[model samples]
Target: MLKSLLSDKPGARPLVEAIRACRWHLLAAAGFSALVNILYLAPTLYMMQVYDRVVPTGGIITLVLVTIVVFLALGTLAGLDVIRTRLLVRAGLRLDQQLAGRTLGRAMGSHETSARAGQVMREFDQVRSAIGGQGALAILDAPWTPIYLLFCFLLHPLLGLLTLVGALMLFGLAVLNERSTKSRLLKAHEASARAYAAQEQVSTRSEVVRALGMRRGLVARQLTARAEATGAQSEAQFTGGRYSGAIKFLRLMLQSLALGLGAYLAVQQQISAGAIIAASVLLSRAVQPIEQLVGAWPGLVQARAAWKSLTDLYEATGDQDEAHTLLPAPAGRLDLQEVSVRMSDGDTPQLKQVSFSLEPGQMLGVIGPSGSGKTTLARVVAGAYRPQLGAVRLDGSEYGQWDPERLARHIGYLPQDSVLFAGTVKDNISRFEGAADPAADQGAIDLRAVTAAKAAEVHDLIQSLPQGYDTPIGPGGRGLSAGQMQRVALARALYGSPRLLVLDEPNSHLDQDGETALMRALKRAAEAGAAIVIVAHRAGVLASADLLLVMNKGAVSRFGPRDQVLQALQGRGGPRIASVS
Candidate 1:
């Protein structure tokens, strides 16, 4: 099963693999951090020198020189720190750039997976942000923490032991933070992704919600889901906060304890007063990495979970090769060989061993009652749903053997509720070519868009707009009615003289004139040698179908010439017209 879904393409490695390529940047950043840690010793030493040498000998010039040297070293260290930060940021960006396309491609296939997988892009973003966030910075500085402990050891053995015990305590707290928060963080992330998908569904059906007075109900549901996710996130943060606060408290107390111990040693003649201050500073530095780690633990957990999600997607998108077979243009010789497609639950097949055949210059109308698989059959015919059994063949070759992008070019599918994005009517009709590129292939794209509009018999209707073809018609700009959106979508389906056209409820919103225009377009397409399958309920459109397939309860009830099926249906007790599925 994994082999079938996962692409075997050479470039399809997980995003984590790309992250490994940035190790050099990480290494260089670590080297800079090491230097920074070395420079940190300057403050302790300068203080020690001032107390022991300058003050004791009354050497004012020595004190001034030591201060100047320490400031210069600190200034250089600050510059190196900035450069290292920039390097990490750029590395994160480069990692994101390398994997963004791959991640989006995986997301494009989300229609086949769980709703939560639809937000793979968000998961990728999380990983990218965490890579450059404070969590990663803390990890970089963590390794040098022991060096500070070693400095504390050189100050006095008792002080070193005291700081080590304290550092270990904070390290234990950091581990506790991860243990307490990791699972909640993962759950929160999943909940957030699902909430996003739910909100997306609500946005698409905003008109329906308002019309049915379901706004309050829908809003309540969305808020409830979001609140649950936010609650989980808050719990994780609260856990992290407790650990961070405890680590800070322990570090402060340990610093004071190190001072008290050092002062005791000084009185015993084992160490001087200057050594006490140095010991305190070194002890704080020793535990600082553990404190930062505790603070950034939640982000680290989120990033780990995101990595797993993204990696799973990359694996599932399996080796769908783009090197499509250079087969000759099909003659629209379509065949469904005992095809079957199980619904989402896999308990019952929506299309059960359905079979059909069509040749060029023919139009097949599929009619059925609601829940009779009319839409499912249309989707299978258009290659949107891969059959669970048998084959969808074009010109004697299975469509599964061809790259989907190439197969789509020769095919046009207008679903039950055709949708348009944020663009002009012309752009929507040309499938965004008019909007995507106005400077290159300008003339050719315009000609294709106009030709498609003319074929759909809506050219004059479009010309009536203020800017004609260029008039914006999506969500933000002037919106078109349902009939207009369907006609424009029909024009999109009619583009490029496709060899195969599959439409579901083409006239679901059209008026009588629009229906007439659709008939003319169907006839023209058939005359041009395109095989068309139109799912419709209206008998008027069926008048032009060369063949008819009547479906009932997920099976083909009858298949023959249009007249034969119509004659049979006329003799029945009730006319089995198509219903929206």
Candidate 2:
């Protein structure tokens, strides 16, 4: 255990590293607690002196002097306890600072449908709460158990023996508590994860669920999941509480039993009246830490489980954000050499051995039937989905070799289904630039956002809103039409005038005028020396393309200049003619 705690192996868990780094804090807190416990003996010794020395000698002056000095010692002890608690809180905050951002970043870069991606944050919260609070205090005080027992031994051998036996019994109960609740907590965690996942799915597809009258069924399913989780959690907590209650009972009874035993010893002239009370006091102090440990057991288990879960997730995802030397920003050159992507759920391959290349100022139109790998190709181009086989490169450097955030600045992507965050039109367009920074120059940010909106042809519609670019959108905010959402997403993709633009059916919800605006946007983007890839089934959307690619399943059926592919397809004019232009 000591080796594991001290070792900083290559793949050591982050939580372990946190504990290791806070070792000094833990030691300092324990040192202060030792002093407090020693001072705790002051009260017991004072009682011994009062009954055995003060009452017998009629020594009022001695009693007052002892009282004064013991109170001062206890006051210092309380102050030390306060400092110990503060140190633990600081350690917890430092641990949070170390892991929170990394966990959030990994979650953000992870797949949108990832179940564990969201769980890491909650797990970290559990760890932080457990570390800085009562659980840690109990652990810090636990080591003094043996020292308290030794004090009882000095008072009388029989009292010390009783304390040792009582401590063993209470420790046994604590072990049993762990044994009873460990599996239940694990089950509860799994059930809660399922419940959360079900609720997230229901929320994301709320429209369809409500429209189809499936809301009742979805809600019922979520409730059932939540019930199972809550039931398991309640059962485990009940078991832990039962054990803690038993430990408390044992601690109280042991002290009373010690007093009784010490009285018998006094009657036999083995000890004095002072020793009787001192024996009980010493036994209580010995049992105090064990009782506190029992109370803290459940929280400790939860933190341990959370640490294990986070470590497992980090290992499974392998999302090591390497900060290698920055390659120069990509120059709009993209190459795909026999790329293929396998579905995570063991579905059929989405794209198979599809290869293509694009240069600066080139615009490629991908026309295919539904599920013919068009959207997959667009995602690959935008670096949204890394292919399982082959490679994607920009400017002769592998995509993984570039810093993702920097690479993202040079890439623009509009998914098949448009998405809008809970923010203003300008915030969505500017990707929350000035909004995230309260001190940013808002006027300059608004001007830049408006320019992008005009480029996507959503500026006039936005200006018509109650607050123009600052108009709120999302749940409880101003609701935009489906076409408006698509246009705003388009404006977002075009915001930075990115060197590489991937639009997966950007005009899916657009009207005739919207389509015209989209054509102009594409033309302007291409003329500005940006490489654009569009996945569209609409023949009219293809008229502005400089190159054409057709997909008959997952394989490319045809690839050539726009006029050649269109002319050959026109000569044939088969079933695909309407979709491919």
Candidate 3:
């Protein structure tokens, strides 16, 4: 199962590639570490000579010189060790930045279904932690271990053979552990994803939960998800730990055997005492790096899993075609012909052969009962989704042919939930990326845009705040009420001065007075020659529209001038239409 999860994600290559691209720096650090190990190994040989040869010769001066040389060698190795550490740390930081950039870039285009933004963020953090922690050491140690083993073999081939066998056995055990715990690791990943999703949802809808008196229910659900995740993690750790313990035991036995054999050979005079001592020292040095690699196995697995997850997300979202050449702004003429949208299940269609058109500067209000596909139709018109069987044309040009950014410049879309970022009201209004217009500039405030805000009736509310337009709204504008948020959204839409505006349930949460203000804003926007299309439920809002479109079962059941549609609806005993001011 872990293998399946890893294989399922093709997007992981970029992350892996990013790491591999920094191999030169890693190799340089590994070289320095290897040099330090060699210097440190010299002391053991010199000490053995002092005991076995120098004392027999009674060479007191030679002993003093050898001791000083060993200390110098030790100091040199210590300096090199510091250099290697610094280099690896620097390289790891670079990798972190690269990973963060790649992850965030992928998040920008990732599919909504995959919940990619959060996933990418988590993966990027994991990759960073892995590199900064044991990951760099593992890279250095894995390759350096063989070099040390070769040095041991040069000291004495027999002891080298024994050490090689032990290392091989330890490696085999680690591989077995990895394979056995693979499924557990995958389960843990899935559990973590579910837990994160549940937590995020609970956080986002905390207010709703409290209002509906479902706080206990939400808390219970969150706890269940967290528990499941914790359990899965525990199981994975237990399984991995069992195999790790066994491997460590086997390694310890092998090291002991190598030490015993070396000492025996030295006593028999088959190998020089200095050679035996060097072998023993090299063997000891090998143990820590070997153990480190073994210990790093779990992190490697997790990094792989994270890599795969990121890859899957990127693949799913990155396959979109490049945006075409930018097209000129449309005349606000839109037409949808034989449009149909089928859900992924391919059984129930959300929209079926729906068609409509609006003349330039016209105000069209779409009314429908719940589940009548009103929002779906608006999304199709706004170019959020492509229809399965038809086309959406704006000013005689197909939406797909126009550059997405350019199309956005012409069409303003406000979804049911107006997402606000962590910024002041003015920042949200001027989301456009460019130099400030000199004519609109007023210190930190854009006076021209602020005038639009006043027209939208949100200007007074903003000024009432402690910082006025500069007040830092927390994430998602949590500081603002729903009505205030709606007006802010409207002001943002108007700030773009878009040729066409598509709003879905713009005033759903507004009070009567706020709704009146919204109507006035819409009338002003229409008078400015901006084509406005709104999905509305209230008769008061619908009555003010120049045209009314009533949708039923994914198709337009009635559409005409407001008065005609209202008269027909009243005659049919449908909802009464209110007067338009």
Model 2 clash tally?
Answer: 0
State the local distance difference test value for candidate 3: 0.75
Using lDDT as the measure, name the better of candidate 2 and candidate 3. 2
- Worst lDDT run of 10 residues, candidate 3, spans 1-10
Q: Which stretches of candidate 1 lie over 4 Å from their true place?
A: 1-17, 110-113, 343-347, 434-440, 476-478, 569-575, 578-581
Ranking by lDDT: 1, 2, 3
State each model's CA lDDT, in order. 0.83, 0.82, 0.75
Q: Model 2 segments beyond 4 Å from truth? A: 1-24, 111-113, 204-208, 313-320, 435-447, 475-478, 548-581
Clashes of 3: 2
- Clashing residue pairs, backbone N/CA/C < 3 A, model 3: 11-311, 12-311
Best by lDDT: 1
- TM-scores for candidates 1 onward, in order: 0.92, 0.90, 0.86
- Candidate 2 lDDT (Cα, 0 to 1): 0.82
- Candidate 2's TM-score reads 0.90
Candidate order by decreasing TM-score: 1, 2, 3
Tens digits of lDDT, candidate 2, 1-581: 34543324434355466677777877888888888888889888888888889999999999999899888988998899899999888888888887787777666675434565556788878888887889788887888889989998888888889999999999999899889999998888878877887787678778888799998888788889899999999999999889988998998899889989999999999988998898988888888877887777767777777777666655543545456567776679988898888768757888888888889899899987787888888888788888888889888887887777778878989998887888888888888878557899888878878888998988899889999987899842238888988898899899877889999988889999999999999899889999989888777778777888887667787888988887887777622645443
Model 1 per-residue lDDT tens digits across residues 79-179: 98898898888888888878887677667743364766657778778888887888778888889888998888888889889988998888888888888
